[model samples]
Every structure is written in structure tokens, then in C-alpha cells.
Target: MNQFTDKRKGMDHKDLAVEARGLVKVFGDNRAVDGVDLNVRAGSIYGVLGPNGAGKTTTIRMLATLLKADAGSAKIFGYDVAKDAQIVRQLIGVTGQYASVDESLSATENLVIFSRLLGLSRAESKRKAMELLEEFGLTEAARRPLKHFSGGMRRRLDLAASLIAQPPLIFLDEPTTGLDPRTRNQMWDTIRRLVKEGSTVLLTTQYLQEADELADRIAVIDHGRVVAEGTVNDLKESIGTSSLHLSIQNEQSLSKARLIVERVLNVQSAVTAEGGKITAPMADADRVTDLLITLREAGIQLEELSVQKPTLDEVFLSITGQNTASNTQVKKEELA
Candidate 1:
């Protein structure tokens, strides 16, 4: 099968993995994650999606024990994040947005060091290092310094380093952000394999399609609040009715079609002059039939017409009143 086709395999969810209730984190005057609740079933991928500074990274950090929470509670494998942090740490692996692998060390050396730090014996560390190298398709370049690795390879090694102990839960923060398309697919496959092996994952990403493709459930956060949360289809349904798009033969016909559709549907309608198109939220499937008849009776010629469900981006925009693409770009610049 081709690489594109290969990346479309099904994902399996098996068990309850991570749970959070009223997860809150504050840094001085800033409340990064405010009253967020999450439940990541075992062996499933749960995605946390938001614009930059949406508390995604802060949430992950608190969950991973890298930062302490000001209030609320989080548990991993039944261990409390605040009190039983060490145990929680042992049960989860984390890969941050940026590659955290040691650039001065070779892939093999990096893995070995991480394994030893996790308490593996010297010989066992070597074994674990080799195992991860092979699993991440990095065996051929195992001895290469991380500085020499390509962006994708470095990401793989960074992920591999996080998995040296094979923790049951993994936190991936924008794991595919900087990789090329092929490498992004490769990383997605790697995540799928981890889930298949009964690992629960809590992923935070800015890519809408990535979450739509991989997450069993998605939570959209804005301004440190979860603005919306549901399965992809559920979220789409919550946004409102499907949009009916019509292509008219001319600008005059476009205005007529909009008036007809608005009268029939009793809803606000938009007409685009550039494409001579009209769009409106359709409440019923029969609305299309009625709309076509109205347009025909009005002597308007439509070149094309179709209905489409709201995409994740649309849902986000509806809830937050901000465009995700522009927000992401702004965040990138701030990070830079």
C-alpha cells in the first residue's frame, strides 16, 4: 500500500487511562488552566486542542508533574498528581512541543542515559536503547548525534527517549508541529501503535485534522476554558445545521437565490459575489429540495449546490469568535 493509504488505518481503544477533575493551574497572577476536566479512557487517544496560550501546555505540564497545580486534582493510573507525583510520573511519558533530546548526544547515547536515569541497569539500558531505536525506525542511525538527525528523526528519537520505560500513558504536546507531511504521518502511526499496545494518550495539538483523525474525543480550550468538548461528529452537530452552498450563474441570480433561500428557511443567508454563491444554515434535508424549487421558480440558474457538515475549525470559530489559523500564527510569532 502507498504511504498515504497506510496512514489511514483504524485506531483501537481498550481501557480507561487518565482522569482529571477540576484541573486548575495558576502562575502568580495568570491562571493558565482553569477548572478543566478531562477523562482519557485507557488505550485511547484523547486530544486537547486550542490556540496558543490556551493553557494546553500548562495543563500537560501540571498533569506530568513538571508543575504543581494550585487547585483541583488529577490522577494517572489511580495515583493523585499532587500527592503521589512520583508514582504518577512512573506511569506516564511526556514529549513536549519542542524536541527535548540532547543534541550533544547520539540517539543511542540519549536513550541509554534516559533508561539509566529511569533506574535500568547498564546492560539493560543498552538493550532498551536498541529496542527503541529499532521501533522508531532509527536503528540505522542509532549512533548519529542528535544534531545530525533530521527534524523527523530527532522527533522520533525524542519520543523514543520518552518511552524508554514503556509507561502506560504518554503526553504528546504538539508532537508533529515541525515535521514534514511524511514524517507527520510516521509520527501518527507511532502514536497509533502505542495506543494498540494499551497505552492511553493525552495529546495537545493545534492541528484540527490531526485531532479529528486521531482523538477518540476532543476538548477545545480558549482563554483557559474548555469552550467545547465532544467526539468529532458530536462537536460538528452541536455547531448547528449543515450549510447549504449554492453556485449561481450570475451575480443577479445569486441575490435572488439568497432571498429565496432566506424566505424558505427563515434564516440569515450570505451571498458571495466572487463565486456568485449563497450559503445558509439548513435545518432539514428537505430544505434543499424546497430551495431548488424556489430558485427554479424565480428563474435563477444555479451551477452547483451542496451541503456540508461544519468542520472542526468552524466549530472552534463559532465558540471562540476568533479564527484558529490567525491565532496559531500569532502564537508562533510569540513563541519565536
Candidate 2:
């Protein structure tokens, strides 16, 4: 059995892995994390989704005990972050946005160093290092210096190092941010495996699809506050039951088609920058037949049409009141 698997006895015995209420962090005049509340269930993956500077990282820092909350309280596995920091630290593993591995060390050397520091014997450390490297698909490059590793390779190694002990609760802050599609899929599988092996994951990510795929529940933060929180389906239902997306063959018919859509569906429709795409929320998917007949009568030729559950992208836009535009003017919470 692997070292992590051997140590998994009763790791998921607790019910709540992380609990935070009114978590706040201030940077001078800017309130980085403002009154954020989170309850992460044990042995499940919980996602925190937000655009940049929305305090996702700051809130994570507070929960991980890396930053003291200006106001509010947090606990990991029922141990208070402020009062029982040492104990809390022993129960959680954290992987931040950047890789924390040493640039001069080989992948194997880095993992072995971490395992040894965590009190593993020399032989066990070496064995565990190779095991992790192979799992992360880094065994071929295990002997290469980190300086020579690509960004994705470094990120995978960083996560591998953090899993050497496989603490009960793991805080992954945008762990797959810059990874390519293939590596991201691998990371997703690893995360699922971690939870399956009796670990709870508190993940912070800007990628909505990642949350939709991994999180049992998600909290959407905006302007340092949670604007929405629920399961993916719950959040989608909050906006509408279903979404209608259609495109006309002619650009000239775009405005007329959108008008018919709103008139028939009795809802606001959003126009895309693309040729003739129009999107709208549908409370009753049955109304689409009426919309289609109305459009046909108006001489609109549809190039494509689809009625589907609301996507995470639409949920994010609806909740945040804007697309994921980087606001350089906002007092970024990440500022030192």
C-alpha cells in the first residue's frame, strides 16, 4: 500500500473539514476578504469560484492560517485556526497558485526532501518520491532540475510534493490555472482520487468549468463577497430553468429574430458579437416551439438552435453582472 493510503485510516471521520464565518482581510483601505462564510463538508470537493481580485485567494489564506483574518473566525477539522493553529496546520495540506518547489532541485529530490522533512526514513522517502513522480507523469523527468521543467511540470510536481503526507484537508488555490488541457484532466483525476482516499479538498478556481466538474457545492464570490452559493444545478436554476441559444443564417435578420424571441418567450435576450447568435433564459422550455414558429413566420432562417441547461459561464455572468473582465482599476485584494 502507498504511504498516503496506509495513513488514511479514519481520516474522513470528521464531518466538517473547514468552517469559516465572516472571514475578512484588509489591505490599508481595501477590504480584501469581506465577510466570507464557508462550510466545507468532509471527504468532498468544495469549490470557491470568483474572478481575479475577488478575494478567493485571501479567503483561502485565512482558512489555511497563512493570514490572520482582520475579523471573523475559521476552523479546520473543528480546530480553530487562530486558537489551535499548530494543530490545524498538521491536518491540512495547501497548494497555492504558484509552485513552491526549489528551482535548483530535481523532481525526485524535491519530493524526497519533503517526505524526509515530514519524518519519513531515508529509504521510505526515496520510495515515496518515485511513487509520486510516476503518478504525476514526471518519472521520466524526475532527475531533471526544476529550472528546466515547464510550468505545467512544475505545477504537477508541486502538487505531488504536497500530497507526500496527504493531510486530511487540502487547500488547492487555482491548482490547474496554467496547465494545458491534458494536464488539467490529469489533475482533475488526481483530485478525485484524493477525495476518494478520504481527504476533503477546498479548491479555489477562476475556471467555472473546473468547479462545475469537481465541486459538490460551490460559492461564487464577487467584490470580496459571496454573491451566490449552491450546487451547480441549484445555481443554474437560480438564473433560469434552461437556456436557449440560436443563430440565424443572415446577419440582417438578427435584430428581428431577437425581438421575436423576447416577444414569444417574454424574456430579455442577449446578443453575441458573432454574426447572428442570440441567447436568452427560458423558464419553460416548452415555449421554444412557439418561439420557433414565430421566427419561421418572420422569414428568419436559423443556422443553429439549441436548448440546454444553463452553463457555468452564463451563471457567472449573471451573478457577477459582467463578463470576466480584469479590472485593473479596482483595489486588488492581492496587493501587499
- How close to the true structure is residue 105 of candidate 2, measured as C-alpha lDDT? 89
**Would you estimate the TM-scores of all the predictions?**
0.77, 0.81
Cα lDDT of all candidates, in order? 0.77, 0.82
Predicted candidate 1 versus true structure: per-residue lDDT over 115-224, tens digit per residue: 99999999999999999899889999998888788988988998999888889999999998888999999999989989999888889888777887799888887656
Regions of candidate 1 where Cα sits further than 4 Å from its true position: 1-16, 27-30, 239-310, 318-336
Best by lDDT: 2
Off by over 4 Å in 2: 1-14, 240-278, 282-285, 292-313, 320-336
